[model samples]
Target: MDSDSRLDLEFAYTTYRDCCRDLYSPYYYCRRPLGHDGVHAAGFGSGRVRWEHRPDHAPHLLS
Candidate 1:
């Protein structure tokens, strides 16, 4: 990969790691309601998907 692409990936990974760490902090946990299954489900579901594309963007790119 090009240097620009590598730099972008590094920046993204660092941001993602920082965000994930923030989620586990006590301050973050205390703000949310208990038994919120949908919130947990959404986080779990997001990791399972490897790729995603919006239908609106697809048609423009394909043409």
Candidate 2:
């Protein structure tokens, strides 16, 4: 892949890792980020993460 595409993939993976760490944290219940609906909404309530690749850009996760 090109440099731009590699960068985009790295960024996406970093974001995904950070998100997973935060979502799975035990302290998330008491120290949740702003706008995070409670634990259930942030975790169990959501569907599986889906990654989509666009023809003109890098792949991204669909929330």
Candidate 3:
């Protein structure tokens, strides 16, 4: 895959991992980054993390 596509996949996989590993909200879905009926915040990091998501769900979870 292209670098951009690889980055996107990494972001998606890590978003799922971050939610399961860090987030402890009963409201947020832990299986993966998932949006609520309204919104759910779900991801953060920089450098190696290299990606972040934002609301609608939150981070990736919100959108």
Candidate 4:
């Protein structure tokens, strides 16, 4: 294939890889552990998942 054809093939391959990733393992595939706020601003350093409860809600979590 020519340069343009090769580029098109590479793009197609990347798209297919992303599609498979999203379909099979949308979460926990390449995801790092989230903190209490569920944002990536800062990661928990203790190697443990933590959750913070709202003033009106109870705390819950899974290992």
Candidate 5:
């Protein structure tokens, strides 16, 4: 892939990773970045996270 495409892919991947790390669990579906700003906020469910979801990004429970 070209540099631009590669960057886009990397950015997308990073966004997805950050989404799972900052917004929800790895099992949750995370949308693409909402803005061009670096480290843009990620969205998961309910349009926004609830109080209980503040720690949604926390590590999953070991089973």
Candidate 6:
């Protein structure tokens, strides 16, 4: 896979990951427990695995 001209999605990807990471954190839940899920946009069917939405054991997990 290759991008056509200097396309780097690292920023957007990392930002989203960071946001989700925070939201799923225990501290964030303490601040705001209520959260919601979004429908997959590309017709992700029932075959997709449902991930657990609990906080990581530590920040920057698997880094």
Best by lDDT: 5
Tens digits of per-residue lDDT for model 4 on 1-63?
A: 863454334334443223212111222121222221232111123432222334564322222
Task: After superposing candidate 1 on the true structure, give the runs of residues whose Cα lies further than 4 Å from its correct spot.
Answer: 16-63
Q: List the residue pairs that clash in candidate 2.
A: none
After TM-score superposition, the amount by which residue 40's alpha carbon in candidate 1 deviates from its true location, in angstroms, is 37
TM-score of each: 0.24, 0.24, 0.25, 0.23, 0.24, 0.19
Clash pairs detected, candidate 6: none
What does candidate 5's lDDT look like per residue over 1-63, in tens digits? 753454446446764434333334444332333333333223332443222333335534223
Kindly list the per-residue Cα lDDT of model 1 for residues 1-63, writing each as its tens digit.
963454345334443323222132222211112222222111222231112223453211101
Q: How many residue pairs clash in each candidate?
A: 0, 0, 15, 0, 0, 0
Write down the RMSD of all candidates, one decimal each: 16.1, 14.3, 11.8, 16.2, 9.4, 11.9
lDDT of 3 by residue, 1-63 (tens): 964454445447654535433233434333333332222233333422222234343332322
Candidate 1: residue 44 lDDT (0-100): 23
User: lDDT of each prediction vs. the true structure?
Assistant: 0.27, 0.32, 0.37, 0.28, 0.38, 0.26
Model 3 misplaced stretches (Cα beyond 4 Å)? 16-63
- lDDT, candidate 4, equals 0.28
Score candidate 5 by lDDT: 0.38
lDDT of 2 by residue, 1-63 (tens): 963454344344444324423332333311222333323113212332222223575323233
Find the candidate with the highest TM-score and give its number: 3
Q: Point out the higher-scoring one by TM-score: 2 or 3.
A: 3
By summed lDDT, which 10 consecutive residues of candidate 1 come out lowest? 36-45
lDDT of 1: 0.27
Candidate 2 yields a Cα-based lDDT of: 0.32
